[model samples]
Target: MVLPNLNWRAFIRSQPINIMSRSFAAIFAGYLVAATGSGLLALIIPLPASQSVLIAMMLSFSFYVAAAIWAFSVGTSRQAWRDLLLISAILYIFILWVS
Candidate 1:
């Protein structure tokens, strides 16, 4: 049996943006959303501080994963960046209002 070799060079060449740039955007946006959401949740929830923090930490991972997925799923690099920025801005505004 023969195993197929992955061609990273070809994959990179075919993408609208370089893989590194895409990955960096995804990771950065994901973390920003996660952190902002966690902080907002911690402040707004009625539970004790420790429990709220714990719950925020647990739920933040899902936000991060979802943001990362959205970043990569968009049609173009520009759209991905724009969408992330827009979402982050909205979240920031909500956080400000809640605090």
Candidate 2:
């Protein structure tokens, strides 16, 4: 059996967050969602280490935001959008507290 190789870095760079796409509406929406989420948590959660957990939470949560924006832009239903946002919020909280 033959398997196709995947280039993960290339795939990731193609995402909305990449600098070249920063002005794209979807990318902007993802950033807005991520920033809003981070701000809310920063208000509720006590600050901790700056380098590791905090940064990781920001990065991962941003990706979740990007994925969500992509999903909604592709005509995902309102229910799906709600579910994805809820799941991402939960995941962000879990990561913030556990890490």
Best candidate, TM-score: 1
lDDT by residue (tens digit), candidate 1, 1-99: 996897877776575545555677689977888888888888888999999999999999999899888877887666777887788788889999987
lDDT of each: 0.82, 0.54
User: Clashing pairs in model 1?
Assistant: none
lDDT score for candidate 2 against the true structure: 0.54
Q: After superposition, how far is residue 18 of candidate 2 from its true place, in Å?
A: 19
Q: Compared with the true structure, what per-residue lDDT tens digits does model 2 show for residues 2-98?
A: 8689787786566453433433434444554566455445545655745444764666576656655565555334344454556556756765775
Roughly what TM-score does model 2 have, to 2 decimal places?
0.34
Model 1 root mean square deviation, Cα atoms:
7.7
Output the worst ten-in-a-row residue range by lDDT, candidate 2: 17-26
